[model samples]
Target: MIERILEQSKALIHVLSADRRTRHLVLTWQDTEVLESIHKTLHPLQEFTDALSGEEYVSISYLKPVLHLLKTKTLAEDPVDTDLTKSIKSRVIGYLQDKYNDPITQELLDIASFLDPRFKTNYIGKENIPAVKARMKAKMEEGTRKEKRSRVRDTEFNSLT
Candidate 1:
């Protein structure tokens, strides 16, 4: 919302500035710089949002990798970043970190990433790899045991019939 407003408003501000009567309404050069900074800071997130929201691909497995990229690369502080841009990036990264900070939620996302053939443990930490594998193995075994029990029940029923 803010991003779109910044884009449209910048263009409108330019048009308005061309008129002597409305020139005062135009943003000062510094404020315009701030708006550009905001656009730069948020542009990557828009790309990520659009990509993740697409219908052709599954998105759940992308959560960890995308979050990691946002924190470490896309939103990472750069020497050129204005203070406001830094604050915006930090706030966004912090909020997402808080959401996924819960141990259970983190584990679930890790497991989803692990299960995805394309990702398969790539986003998981080395220390956590064994644990993730153990969890996966346990679920697989549980499913196999249930199937075996079901088959036995079916076999016994057939014999009786």
Candidate 2:
């Protein structure tokens, strides 16, 4: 579970571009503080940037204790802070207020409702199977069409090279 969470976090972080000047990921100052709290769990990981005159790049290494600390941060466990959790939950809900009328979001919510363990899966299994399969098949066909188009485009593009 820890490894899964770690991989998820790592994948997200891998996409974070480093600021050449600050050597820090371009997170907001507030997020930087949150990250620092999280970062302190492990051996100190230092970030460098171009601004650090003689430093070629920032190097941050993940050590074992930090990995262990993050392992315990799994979502399956109740969040340690009730106020923080409720506050964050409400903030996220507020963002969805405008999107409540969207059909796509509705459909996603329907799928999520089924996946949520609180609900029985019977309705999803019997009533939604066709719709789910239709969506899946449509997505599969679209992917195939995209691959074919890309192959043809690549051939055309390469012939001109």
Candidate 3:
């Protein structure tokens, strides 16, 4: 919405400024500057939000990589950013870091992404890879044992019948 308005700003500003009743609604230069800064700061986040919202494509494993991209590329402060844009970027980066900084949460993400074939170990921290691998091994072995026990039980029941 803001993008569209900004795109047609010249025409819209002329129309709004020309009308007595709507003249009061015309955005001042300062207001447009602030709005433009805000729009620029937040525009990159929309793609991340939309990608994460999808059930078919998104998975828990995507969160860590997406956050990494957000901090390193999408939300990084640019040299040309206005003060307001820089501040907004900083707060968003800070929020994402704090939100995912918990030890358990980090481990969960590491394990999930590591288990995923498409990303296995690509995004996992070097320090975390060993632990995540160990957990996956344990789980796979546990599943194998359970399967063996179930097969044995079925065989015993079939023999009795």
Candidate 3 local distance difference test against the native: 0.89
Provide the lowest-lDDT 10-residue window in model 3: 50-59
For candidate 3, lDDT tens digit of each residue in 3-43?
A: 88888888998999898999888878998998899899888
Q: TM-score of model 1 relative to the true fold?
A: 0.85
Q: How many pairs of residues in model 3 come into backbone collision?
A: 0
- Which candidate comes out best when scored by TM-score? 3
lDDT of each residue in 1-161, candidate 2, tens digit only: 33333435555455654435544654455654454434333212222122222345321121112222323342113445344444443453354355453666545544544444454243343666568657767888999999999999999999999
Shift of residue 14 alpha carbon in model 2, Å: 54
For each candidate in turn, the TM-score is 0.85, 0.30, 0.92
| Candidate 2 local Cα displacement, residue 78, angstroms | 22
User: Per-residue error at 151 for model 3, in Å?
Assistant: 0.7
- For model 2, the local distance difference test gives 0.45
